[model samples]
Target chain A: MTRIACRQLAPRIGDLPFNRELSAAAIRDAAGADVIVLPELVTSGYMFASPAEAAAVAVRPDHPLFAEWAAAAGDAVVIGGFCERGDDGLLYNSAAVVDRGGVRAVYRKTHLWDAEKSVFTPGDRPPPVVRTSAGPIGVLICYDLEFPEMTRLLALGGAHLIAAPVNWPLVERPPGERPPETVIAMAAARVNRTFIACCDRAGTERGQEWTLGTAIISPDGQVLAEAGEGAQATADVDLLLARSKALNSRNDVLADRRPDLYSPLLHRRAPS
Target chain B: MTRIACRQLAPRIGDLPFNRELSAAAIRDAAGADVIVLPELVTSGYMFASPAEAAAVAVRPDHPLFAEWAAAAGDAVVIGGFCERGDDGLLYNSAAVVDRGGVRAVYRKTHLWDAEKSVFTPGDRPPPVVRTSAGPIGVLICYDLEFPEMTRLLALGGAHLIAAPVNWPLVERPPGERPPETVIAMAAARVNRTFIACCDRAGTERGQEWTLGTAIISPDGQVLAEAGEGAQATADVDLLLARSKALNSRNDVLADRRPDLYSPLLHRRAPS
Candidate 1:
């Protein structure tokens, strides 16, 4: 069985060593798995006290912890998020897909959320779907999943699965309701017809807790597997089923799109 | 007979008199109706050349079109989108629920799409359900429907029917597939367990042409009724049946939710 895992991580803000140790340990625990994903910016948590703090925690790819993770998870392909210094000397919210062969690929999020916009410039363009030992993998940080167009593009590029690393905040629209995380996971899964494995960080980051909805949403929009509330959880996924759904006809939101018209909308100036 | 007229209209963006006149004419064509609904942002076009151009068309309770539309519709209650100058002096993408007594309630969109952020701010808050001639009517703009919380709030607040006006862009993701608008509509209707009257503007606008697949989605996530391909459409709603469905305990997403966990997630901050 080609098993994929989405592991919920618990990281303290600004505690890079603790987060890195946790991630390395988790990768070790997920040994022999075909693939694994972790939450976005987990190396430095969701937010930093200032740019200096962020820069200090954001180590270079050559940093020892990353190499340790790659060596530890050498048996399985791993994808995780970290803060990287771009060539332009700016910081980027990047996802690094790796194997024992060093970094397999890197994807910088094209769409930046509110505070993110101030910290990082949007990426130049979306990365192409990369072939993996398990399947074709496409990686997006948080916020990118909400834009159907971005995911649709990845689907068109023949990605069998989409891996997202999110730090979903706690929300309560009703005294009780479906968390936005579940909805987004469900929507992404249904539209792309691909396995969506997202690692959501858990625990309270100074009273602002995350909904640790570590979930593996199926192509049919079912939560095939999910972890428990709070800190850590893991899910198992059958990679083949994800590809089958990607190739399926009826519900393929990407395959069904009339791109001729939308490509224009993708540009800054969409038609009225 | 409790007749409701759900017409798909393409009122000129920001042309108040033209929009009112177009609706009045439709109302005349379907006289003795209990309700009338127009397209999303019907008061203004989807893309505004500038914020001022968009705001130039907004209206409030004292606007002349409000009285004119209510009177012209005679006994029918009208729901449609218009620009409203909010308390903060900014404009909102608002929908006015008008009846003989005047404007019953107004709902601004909770979730603003890409370009909309440049012009309109998100509605101050989720609105309370308003009692309508047919039953309790809840109002939300287009993107708001995408956020499940918007619908859940109204459903929890006792809304049996939801009226949404939308300006959907035309796009071809697949060679021969239905537009995203159709799929989203069905998804919203099914998830909310309320009859969805979605009036969408068809045809090309300013620079972007749109796919005109307007329809009324049923509580079961099916397109109960659909319109033709262009700037006009309509569908009849059976309020009694929808109410009965909501009342029943079977097959409703609303009843199946695990509210305890969801409430915290709904109001949570966006993922970092």
Candidate 2:
């Protein structure tokens, strides 16, 4: 069994020093877990007024904070989001996959959310599936989870588990229903037959409340653990179970795909 | 506003004459609805013992049954499934879109489910989005909804509503939870910002039970109506609402797709 833990922390806006310690502490607390996840923009809180404000807290991948997180993680793999300062001097909404050694992979957020278009540049490359001590872990940022193609690609790339760091802004939903983003994640997990851990941030930032819908979904699309008015959600699951996409004797989800008929999805324009 | 109705009628296995009257009666009962949906293989029930058993009731597009359905439909559009006899003498699991004007389009199930592979030929063509009096309606059959690419492609093809004919086999799920298939449909609707009406069959055939999870979902991914121990589920919705994929000022669901980075999904082989 692989233990997965998600920390739903509240980051102070533009306060990198405070968040750095908070994230490291969370990682240390869940050090025994095989995988630990933190919310998107946990290092620099979301709801920035301008690009300059976001850039103020942005850090490069080599920043010492990752090393701290690595040290705290021990044998576990940690996936958490940050405001990134790219080599090209542009800002990006990025997530880093770190183990005891160091930063293993960095994936920039491809599909930016509502106000993020003005604050960060969208990523050009696809998210990575890093081979970790726990298993193969795929990484995706907040809004990227909404795109089915993104999850499909990661699953096809042989990811046993997908760690998503999302800051889902509060939206109106019917009473007793889960957040829409969580529903999307559940569907993605079931269709791909892959485990998914979505870490959502807590607390309101600049009058914007969050859904706070952190969840750890099993391969069968069941919510094994959910952070309900809590700072953490954890679950112990057989991650290897996700490696088999078969639903029954004859039906394997990944093997059943008809890619040749999917070329229409490659077109950029919406039908008129 | 479009009045969408789904009739969850149970078909007798290998009894086409009985099912033909059953479906036509249901369509006539909901003739006032703008769109009416029926379960997959409603004409020839699921659980065929052999390919010959399925082919015994397979139909062509020009079958008189469709004309009967058109007559019963009045001004409404009807979308339902059947075992199809192709020109090449192969059998397919297919759905037909019909109206007072007769058959608008026929879409064969591209993704066949368990046991279906042994009885039907997989479709080479993509599902079609047909322009109807109600709105632009896309078609999918049974297991096809599980494939995110199928839904994504249909939504991208300017479908305001996806009319699906599904025969969901009963599967194990946690108590008090909706069927997994319904969950998948909800997620697909939300991500694509398109309304979906899934018509599921009822009753047991050959000792095989059904999920009976027929649901009509809004663009926001909320269930507008569900068939609960009943033969019908109906909802009044503005189909045009799905045309705008905008969630907020800067985020439009369809416009946010990064197709350039999705080439990996076109590959058929699983990663080793």
B60-176 in candidate 1: lDDT tens per residue? 657887787788777777888778887678888888888888888887876666678789887656654688777888887776665444555565566777888777776545444
lDDT of 2 by residue, A1-272 (tens): 99999999999899999999999999999967999999999999998989999999999999999999999999999999999999999999999999988999999999999889998999999999999999999999989999998888999999999999999998999888888898999999999999999999998889999998999999899899988543789999999999999999988888998887877554545755
For candidate 2, write residues B196-262 as lDDT tens digits: 9999999889999999889999999999998864378999999999999998999988888878788
Query: What is the TM-score of candidate 2?
Result: 0.98
Residue B125, model 1: Cα distance from true site in angstroms = 36
- How far is B94's C-alpha from truth in model 2 (Å)? 1.0
Native-to-model Cα distance after best TM-score fit, residue B223 in candidate 2, in Å: 0.6
Tens-digit lDDT track of model 1 for A1-272: 66777678777778888888988888888876778888888788876666776777776677777787788886788888888877677788888888877787878876666566566666765654778887788887776665444554555566777888887776553333345556655665665577778778877776777777777777766666677643334456676665543332322343323233223222321101
Q: What C-alpha lDDT, on a 0 to 100 scale, does residue A47 get in candidate 2?
A: 86
